[model samples]
Target: MKIREHLSLLAVLCSMAMVVLDAGMLNVALPTLSNALAVGPADIIWSVSAYQMALLVGLLPSAQLAERFGHRRMFVAGLMIYLAASVLCSVSPNLLALLVGRVFQGLGGAVIMALGIAILRVVLGPDRLGKAIGWNALVVALSSAAAPALAAAILAAGSWQWLFLAKLPIGIVALAASIGFPPSNSTRSSIDGVAIVIHAASAVLILFAFERLNSQPAMATVALVGVAGLARWMIAREKMRQVPLWPVDLLANRPLRTAVYASVACFTAQSAGLVALPLLLQLGLGTSVIDTAIVMMFWPVAVAVTAPIAGRLSERADPSILCSIGGMLLGAGLLIACFSPASAGLSPYVAAAVVSGAGFGLFQVPNNRTMFLSAPPDRAAAAGGMQGSARLSGQTFGTLLVGLLLGYYPTTDAVSLAVGLGGLSALVASMVSFSNLPRFVQRHHA
Candidate 1:
C-alpha cells in the first residue's frame, strides 16, 4: 500500500513537472519557433498566450468535471490529452496548427493543475498532506529553475520540435503509472452548462484584458466591460442554483477566503519581485546576462531547500503562524533589496533572494494545506481549482503592475519602486495571514 501510494504521488508530480516545464521551455524556444514557422514575432506569442488563456479559463470547468466524473479519470484523461497535444505541437508545420495544439495542451494542463492537489489530499490524507504538498512545491520550483537550461540544451541538440517531443516519454510514464490508481467514488452532480459557459467566458475575458491592457488599451477596455457583465450574470445565475459551478459556498468560509486572499497577495508580490529583480541586476547594477542568471538561481534553490522543512514543520506547527512569518520574511527580503546600496554588490542581492525565496516556499505549503483541509472532502476539486485561479490571477496582476510602473516611469529607480510595492504587498499578506490565527485558535479550542 505504501509503495502504491508512492507510485501514485510520483505520477502526480511528474505530470505537474511536465506542464510547468513546458510553459517555461516554450518561452525560450519562441524565437526559434517563429523563424521555423515563418511567422512574425507577434504571431508567435499566441503560442504562449493561447495556452495561458485556455488554462486559466478551463480550470473551474475542469474541476467541476472532475467532481462529476472522477479525479483519477480526469487526471489520466488530461495526461492523455496533453501527451497527444504535445505530439501535435511537435509535428505542426505552421503557426496555426501549433496554436491549436497549444490550446488543447493548455486545457489538459488546466485539468492537471486544478485537480492535482485535490487528488493529493485524498491520497495522503490530512496527517501527511503538508509533506506531500511541500514536495509538490519542490517540483514546481525545480521545473521552473530547470526550464531555461533544459530548453537551451534541447535546442542545442536538435530542432525546437524536440522540446515537445521530449515530454512524450515522461507523459507516457506518468500516465501508465496513474492507471494503477483506484478510481474516485465521488457522487456525480448535475452541471449547469450555461453557468459553465458564462464562467469560462468571463475568466477568459478578464485574463485577456489583463494581457492586452498595456498594449491595446481600447481592446482591453472592451474586454473588461464584457467581463463585468458576464461576471454579474454568472453570480446571479449561481445564486439561483443549489450547487454552483464556481464553489461559492467554499469561498464563503472565512478562513478559506482569507487564505485565498493571502495567496493572491503573496504571489503578486513574488511575481513583481521576480520581474523587477532581473531589471535591477542587468540594467541598474550593470550585471551581465549570464552573471545575472547565475545569481538569480539562488532564489529557487532556496525555495527548493526550504519547502520540505516547512512542510514537516507544518505537521506540528500552526500553518497560519508559519505563513505569517513567511510573509514578513518575504516582505523584509524585498525591502532589503529595495534599500540595497548601489555599491553593495551581489552578496546583498543574493541574500535578499534567498530570504524571499525561502519565505515563499514556507508560505506555500502551509497555505495550500489550509486551502485543501478547509474545504469538505467532496469539494476537493473545487478547492484545488480556486487555488490555481488565485495563483494565476495574482501572477497576472503582478505582471501588469510591473508593466504599468515601467511604462509610466521608464527609469532605473522604477524597478526599485516596483519591488518596494511588492514588499508592501507581502506585508499586507502577512497581516491577512496573522488575522487567521485568532479564528483558528478559537475554532480549535471550541
Candidate 2:
C-alpha cells in the first residue's frame, strides 16, 4: 500500500480501537460506577445500553450527516463531542448526569464507527479493502482484549472516573488526525431527513423494548408497540422516497440481501457468546471479576490471530466456503460449551472460549468483505451504515434471546441456552452461505 493508504489505515485503526475498547471496558467498571454514584443496578445498566442505543439509532443519520455536511467535518465534530462527553463522565456527580454524558458519547461513537468503513472504501480498492477491514477487525479484537486489563488497572490505581478520563486525550488525537486526511467521496444532495427520523425512532423503540424485556415487561410491551408503529411508518415513508434510508433496491438485490441476512446472523451468534460467557463465569459459576475478564480475553485473542489469515485466504478462493465453514465451527463450539458446563475452576469455560472464539474469528472477515463489496461504490457510506446497524441490531437481538431464555430457565441454564441459540443461528447462516458461493465466484470474475 502507498504511504497515504498506510496512514489512512493507521488513523482508522486508532479511532476504531478507541471506540471498540469502550464496548467491553465499561463492564469492568460497572461495579465502581454503581458504588460511586450510589445507583441501583438497574440504572447503572443504562451506561452501556445507552451507548449502544445511540450507536444503533444514530448510525444512518450520521452517514447522511456526513454526506450532507462533510465526512471530515463530521468526524472531527464527533471527536469533539466524544472528548467533551468523556470529560463530563469523569466528573459526573449523579447517575442522571452520567447517563446524560453517556448519551452524547454514544452519539459521537456512532458517527465515528459508521464512517470508518465508508472512509476506507474511498481510500482503498476492493482488493485492498478486505485487508483494510481485516485491520479494522484487528482493532476491534484488540480493543475487546485490552479493555478489561486497562479498566482493571485504572480502577485499582484511581477510581472509575479514570476510565472516562483516559479516553479524553485519545479522542483529541483522533480529531487531529482527521484533519490530515481529506474526504474521499464528493457529497450528494440533501438526504431525506424524514426518512432518517423514521428509522432512528423505530430503532430506538425496538432496542429499548429488547433491552428492557426481562426487567420491565410492561415497558417492553409499550416500547414494542412503538417499534411496530414506527416500523410501519418507516416502510411507508421508504415506499414514497426517491432514495430510502435503507435502500429498497439494494435490499432487493440478491447478493446484498443474503449478505445482510448473513451479517445479522453471524453477528447474533458472535454477540451471544461475548455477552453470555462472561456472565456465566462471573455470575453463574462464581469467579472473580478479573478472572472473568481473563477468560473473556480468549475470544478476542483468537479473532485477532485468525482475521488476517482469513483475509489472505479470501484472495485465493470463495469467501462463501470460508464463511460457511466458520459458521459451522461457531455452532460446534457453542454446542460443545452447552453440553459441558463450566465448573468453578474456569477450565471448562476457557475451553468453550477457545472453540467459540475460533468460530467467530473465522466468520467475521470474509463475511464483512462480502457485505461491503456487494454494494456499489456510491453506496459505501450507506453500506457502512447498514453494516454498523446490522451488527448492533444483531447484538440487541442476541441480548433479547438470552434474556428470554433466562426468564424461562434459571440463571444457571444461561450458557446452555446461549449454546443452543448459537448453534441454531449458525445453521441458518450456513444455509445463506450456500447461496453466496456462486456470487463470490461471479464477482471474482467481474
Candidate 3:
C-alpha cells in the first residue's frame, strides 16, 4: 500500500513538477530566446503571454472534457500532448513555431493541472488525499524555487533547448505508470462550447487589459469595462445550467466559497511578493543578481521544509487554525522584509524569505485539502478546475498590482507598496480562514 501510494503520487504529481520547472526555466530563458530568435522584447514576451492565455482559456474546459471522457485517458493524453509540444518547442527554428508550440503546451498543462485533484482523490482515496496534497504542494514549491537556479546552471553549461528537454525522461516514466494506474469513472455530459468561449473571452480581455494598463490606461479601462460585462453575462448563464463549466454550484457552498476566497488571498500575497522582491533587490537596493537569487531562494527552502510536515498535520488538525497561522506568518515575513535597512546585508532578507515561505506552505496544504474535498465526489473535477482558476486569478491580480505600482513610483517605493498590499492580502487570508472555524469556536470568540 505504501509503495502504491508513492508510485501513484509520482505518476500523477511528476507532471505538475515538470510544468512548474518548465514555467520557471522558460521565464529565465526568455532573454536568451529573444537574442537567439533575433526578436524584439515585445515579440518575445508574446511567448509567455500566449502560454498563459492558452492555459487560462483551456483550464475549465479541459475539466469538462475530462469528465465527459475518462479522467485517466485525458490525463495520459495531456501528458502526450505536453511532451510532444516540448519537443516542438525544443526544435523550433522560428518565433512563430515556438509560439504555436507554447500554446499547445499550455493547453496540455491545463488538462494535467485541472484533473490533478480528481485523480488524487481516486488513486489515494479519502485516507491519503490530504497528505498527497501536501506532497503536491511541496513538489510545486520546490520545483518553482529550484527552476530558476537549475535554468541558470543549465544555461551556463549548454543550450536553452535543454530546458524543455529536461522533462522528457520524467514524462516517459509517468506515462508508463499512468498506463498501469486504476481506471477512472467518466461522467457522461455534454460540454458547452459557447460557455467555454465566453469564459475564455472574459479571461483574455482581463489579461490583455492588465498587460496594457501600464502603457495605455484609456484602452485598459475600456477593456476592463468590457470584461466586467462579459463576466456578468457568463455568471448569469452558468448559474442557470445544472452543471456549468464554471463550478457555480460547488462555489455556492459556503465552505468552498470561503476556501476559494482564502485560496485567492494566499496566492495574491505570494504573487505580489514574488514579483516585487526581484525589483526590490536588484534595482532598488542595487544588489547583484546572484545575491538576490540566493536570498530569495531561502523562502522556497522554508516552504520545502514545512510542506510535508503540514500535510501530515492537516490529516488530524483544524485547517482553519493552520491556515490562519500560516497567512500571518507569511504576512509577518513580508512586513519584516519591507522594513529592511538599505545598508543591511542579506541575512535579514533571508530571514524574511524563510518565514514567508514557511507560512505559505502551511497555508497551502490545508487550504488546498479543503478546496479539493469540499465538493461532492461527483463534482471533484469541477472543484479542481475552480481551485486552479482561483490560483490564476490571484496571481494575475497580484501581478497587476505590482505593474501598476511600478508605473506610479520608483523601484523602492513601488516594491514597498506592493509588499504592503501583499501583507494586507495575507492578513485577509488569515481572517477569512479564521472564519472557517466551527460554530462553537466562533461563538466562544464572539
Candidate 4:
C-alpha cells in the first residue's frame, strides 16, 4: 500500500474507532448524564435508544445512497454530521437536545459503518482484504473494551461533556485524511421511496419492540407483530424490483446467508457474556468497578492480539474451520465463567475472559471475509450493510436476552444462567460454522 492508501486506512480506522468508542462510552456515562440533565432513569434510556434506532433504520438506505452518490462524499458528509452532533451533544442543556443530537450522530455513524468495509474492498485487493478486515475488527474490539475505562478517566478529569468534546480532534484528523481519497463514480438509480419507508418502519418497529420487551410487554408484542407484517411486505415488494434497495438477492446466496446467521449467533453469545459478566462481578461477587474493569480488560486485549493473526491465517486456511474452532473456544470460556463461584478470586474470571475474547477475535475476520467475498462486487455496499445490521441486531438480542433471564429467574443466579445460555449459543454457532466447512472445502477444491 502507498502512503496515501495507508493514510486513508488510518482515517477510516479513526472514524470507526470513534463510533465504537462513543457507543461503549455512553453506556458508562448514562448515569452521570441522567443526574446532570435532571432526567428520570426510564426517560434517559431514550438517549441511547434514539441513537440506535436511527442507526438501524439508516444503515441499508445509507449504503444504497452511497452507491447512488459516492462513498467518499458520503463518508465525509457522515464525519461532518457526527462532528457537529458531538458538539451539540456536549453543549445540550436538556435531555431532548441530547437525544436529538445523538440521533444525528447515529445517522452519521450508520454511513461510516456501512461504507467503511465497502471502501476497504475498493482500496485493498482480494489477497489483502482479510488482513485489513482483521485489523479493523481489532480496532473495534479494542475501542469497545477500552471505552469504559477511557470514559471514567475523562469524567475524572472533567465533566461528562468532555467526552463528546474529545471526539472533535479525531473527527478532524479523519476528515483531513479522507479528503485525499479519490471519489467513487456514482451509479444512476431511481430512489425507491416506498421501499425506504417500509425498510425504515420495519427496522424501527422491530428495534422498538425489543427495547420495550422488558418494560411494556403489551406494546412490545404489538410492535413485534407490526414489524413482522412490515418485513413481509418489504420482502415481497423488493422481490419484484430488479435493483432493490434491500438487496434480497445477495442474501439469497446460501453460503452468505449461513455466514450471516453464524455471525449473529457468535455476536449474540459474545454480547450476552459481556453484559452478564459485569453484573456477576460487581453485584453478585461484590467486586469494585475498577476491579471489574481491570479484569474485563483482558478480553478486548486478547482480541486485539489475536485478530490480525487470524486474518492472515484465513488466507491460507478454511475460514469455516477457523470459525468453528473459535466458537468452541468461546463456548468453553463461557462455560467456565458459568462455574465461577461467588467467593472465587479474579484469576478464574480473567482466564475465561481471555479465552472468550481470543475465540471471538479469531472467528470475526474470517467470517467477515466469507460474507464480503460471497457477495457480487456490485453489491458490496449491501453486504457491508447486512453485516453491520447483523452485528447490531445480535447485540441487541443478547442484551435483551440477559435482561429477560434476569427477570425470569429473580431468585436464582441470573448471571450464571445467562452466561450458560451464551455458551449454548456459541456451541450452536460452532455447529453452524462446521456445517459450512464442506461447502468451503468444495469451493477451494473447485
Candidate 5:
C-alpha cells in the first residue's frame, strides 16, 4: 500500500479496534460496575443498551452529517465525542451518569462505524475496496479476540473504571492520526433534516416498544401505536421531501433489499450466539470469568483466520453462495450446541464459537461489497446509511428479543431459548440462501 493508503487504513483500524474492544470488555465488567455504582441489575443493563440506543438514533443523522461536512471531518469529530464520553464513563458516580455517558459514546460510535467503511471504499477506490474491507474485518476480528482477555486483566488489577480508561489513549491516538491525514474529496448533499428526525424517532420508538412490551404491555402498546403512527407520518413526509434520509428509490432496489435482509438475518443469528454463549459457559458449565474469556476467544480468532480465506473465495464465485454456506454452517453449529449433553462441558461452546465466527467471517466481506457496489456512486452515502441502519437495527432487535425470552422463561432455560432462536434464524436465512442456489450449483460444476 502507498503511504496515504496505509495511514488511512491505520486510522480506521485504530478507531474501530477501540469500539469493538469497549463493547466486549464492558460485558465482563458489568458485575463490577453494578456493585461499585450501587446500581440495580436493571440499571446496569443500560450501560450496554444506552450505547446501542444512541447508535440506533444516530445512524442516519451521522450519515447526513458526513455528507454535509465530509467523512473525514465526521470521523475526527466522532473520535473526540467518543473520547469525552469515555471520560465521563470512567468517572461516573451514579447509574444515570454512566448511562448518559454511554449514550454519548454510542453517538460517537455511530459516527465512525459506517463512515469508516464508506471512507475506505472511496479512498481505496472500487478495485481494491474488497481487499480493504477484508483487512478492516481482519483487524476487527483480532481486536475483538483480545478484548475479553484484556478486560479480565484490567479488572484483576483495578476497578471496572479501567475499562473506560483503557480506551482513552487509543482514542487519543486515533484522533491524532485522523487529524494529521489529508482530507478526502468532499461530497455534499442537500440533507433532509426533518426526515432525519422522523426516521430517528421512529426507530427509537419501535425499539423501545419492543424492549418494554412484556413488562408493561399497556405502556408498550401505547409506544407501539405511537411508533406506527410516526412511521406512517415519516413515510408521508419523506414522499414530500426532495431527499429523504431513508431514500425510497434506494431501498426499493432488489439487490439492496437482498443485502439488507441477508444482513439482518445474519446478525440476528450472530447476536443470539454472542449473548448466549458466554453466559452459557458461565451459567451452564460453571466457567470462571477468565476461562469464559479464553473460550470466547475462539470466535474472533476464527474470524481473523477465515476472513482472508473468505476474501479469496469471494473473488472466484458469487458472494451469495458464500453467505448461504455461512448461514447454514452457523445454524448447524448452533444446533450441535443446542443438543449437546450437559456433560459435554466446554466442547460444545468451543465448536459453536469457531463455526459461527467462521461463518460470520465468510459472510461479512462479500455481503458488504455487494451492498456498496450495488448502489450508485453518487449516492454511496445513502447506501452506506441503509446498510449500517440494517445491521444496527438487526442487532438491536436481537438483543431485545433475547431480553424478552429471558424475561418470559426460566433462568435455567436461557441457553435453550438462545439455541432455539439461533436455529430459527438459521432456517430462515437458509431459505433466503436458496435464492443463490443456481449459482452455488454452477460453482460446484465448474
Candidate 6:
C-alpha cells in the first residue's frame, strides 16, 4: 500500500481500537470500580450495559446522521463527545454519574464504529477492500485479546479512573488523523425522525429483553411482544421511504441478506463458545482462573494470524467456499473441544481453540467483505451498521442462551452443552454461507 493509504488505515484502526478498548478495559476494572463507588456488583454492571444499549440503539441512526451531516463531521463530533464523556466517567463521584458518562460514551462510540469501515473503504478503495478489512479485523481481535492484561496493569498502577482517562490520547490521535477525509456532498436531507425512533427503540428493547430473559421471564416476554408490534410498524414505515433508516431495501437483496444470516450465526457460535469455555475449562480440566484465561488467549491470537491471509486470499478465491470451509472448521473444532478427554492436558483444548479462532478469522473478513461490497456505494453506512448490529445481536443472544441454560439446568454441565450448541450454530452458518454460492460465481463475472 502507498504511504498515504497506510496512514489512512492507521487512523481508521485507531478509531476502532479506541472504542473497543473502552469495553475491554472496563471488564477487569468492574470489581475495583464497584468497590470504589460503593455500589453493588449488580448495579455496577449497568455501567457496561448502559454503553452497550446506547451503542446498539444509536448505530444505525448515527449512520443515518453521518450520511446527512458528513462522515468527517460526525467522526470529529463523536471524538469530542467520547473524550468529554471519558472525563466525566473518570471523575464521577457515584454510579449515577458513571452510567451517564458511559451512555454518552457509547453513543459516541456508535458513531465512530458505524462509519469506521465506510471511511476505510473510501480511503483504500474497493480493489484493496478485502485485504484492508482483514487488517481491521486483526486489529480488533488483538485489541480484545490484550484488554484483560492491559486493564490489570492499569489498575495496579493507578485507579479505575485512569482506565477512562487513558482513552483521551487515543481519541485525540484518531481525531487528528481522521480530519483529512473529503467532506460528504450529501445534501441536508431531512432524516426520518419517526423511523429513527422506532429503530432505536426496537434495538434497545431487544437488548433489554435478551438480558432479562434468564433473570425475569415475564419482563422479557412483555418486551418481546412490544418489539414484535414495533417491528411490524417499522417494516410498513421503512418500505415506502427512498432511504429508509431500517434499510429494508438493501436487505431485500438476497446475497446481502444471506451473508447477514451467515454472519449472525457465526458470531452467535463465537460468543457462546467463548463464554462457556471458561467454565468448562475450570470445571472439566481443573484449570485455575489465570490458567483458563491464558488458554483462552489462543483463540484471538489465532484470529490475528489468519484474518489478514483470508483478506488477501479473498481477492483471488471464491469467498463462498472459503467461508463455508471456515464455518465447518469452526464447528468441527468446537465439537472436538467438547469431546476432549478430561485426562488430557490443556494442549488438546488449546489446539481446538486455535482451530476455532483461525476458522472465525477466515470466515469474518470475507463474509464482511461480501456484505459491504454487495450494497451500492450510497448504502455503505447502512450496510456497515447492519453488519455491526448482526454481530452484536448474535453475541447478546448467545450469552443470554447460556445464562438461561445454566439457571434452568443447575448441577448439569451446561458449559459443554453450550459449546455443543455453539457447534450447531457454526454448522448453520456454513450452510447459509454456501447457500449464497451462486451469487459469488455470478458477481465474479459481473
Question: What's each prediction's TM-score?
Answer: 0.97, 0.92, 0.96, 0.97, 0.91, 0.97
Per-residue lDDT for 183-255 in model 6, tens only?
A: 7657566699988888888888888888788779899999999999999999998888888888899999887
Per-residue lDDT tens digits for candidate 3, residues 14-92, read: 8899889999999999999999899998999999998899888888898888878878888889899999999999999
Candidate 6 global CA lDDT score = 0.86
TM-score of 1: 0.97
lDDT of 5 by residue, 1-446 (tens): 77777777788889989999999899878888989999888889888888888887887778777777778888888889998999999999899899999999999998878688787777777777777777878988998778877898999998888999988888777776665455745655676767777777787777678777878888889988998898888777777755567656677766566777888887788778777776767887778987787777888888898787787776676778787787787787777777777797887778877887888888887777778877766556667777778788767666766777788887548666786687568656655755756755776899
Rank list by lDDT: 1, 4, 3, 6, 5, 2
| Tens-digit lDDT string for candidate 1 (46-137) | 99989988898888888888888889999889899999999999999999899999999999999999998888788778899999989999
Q: What is the lDDT of residue 214 in candidate 4?
A: 81
lDDT to native, each model: 0.89, 0.77, 0.87, 0.88, 0.78, 0.86
Off by over 4 Å in 3: 2-4, 440-446
* Residue runs of model 5 more than 4 Å from their true location after superposition: 179-188, 240-242, 282-292, 343-345, 433-446
**Where does model 6 exceed 4 Å of error?**
1-4, 442-446
Considering only N, C-alpha and C atoms within 3 Å, which residue pairs clash in candidate 5?
none
Give one digit per residue, the lDDT tens place, for model 2 in 189-288: 6778778777778877887778778889999999988888877777776767654676664676676677679878978887777777767676666889
Q: Candidate 5 deviates by what RMSD?
A: 2.9
lDDT of 4 by residue, 365-424 (tens): 988998888887767878888898988888887898898888778624888889888988
Q: Which one wins by TM-score: 2 or 4? A: 4
For all candidates, what are the clash counts?
A: 0, 0, 0, 0, 0, 0
CA shift of 390, model 2, Å: 0.7
Model 4 C-alpha lDDT versus the unseen true structure: 0.88
Clashes of 6: 0
User: Which of candidates 1 and 2 is the stronger one according to TM-score?
Assistant: 1
How does residue 169 of candidate 2 score in lDDT? Answer: 63
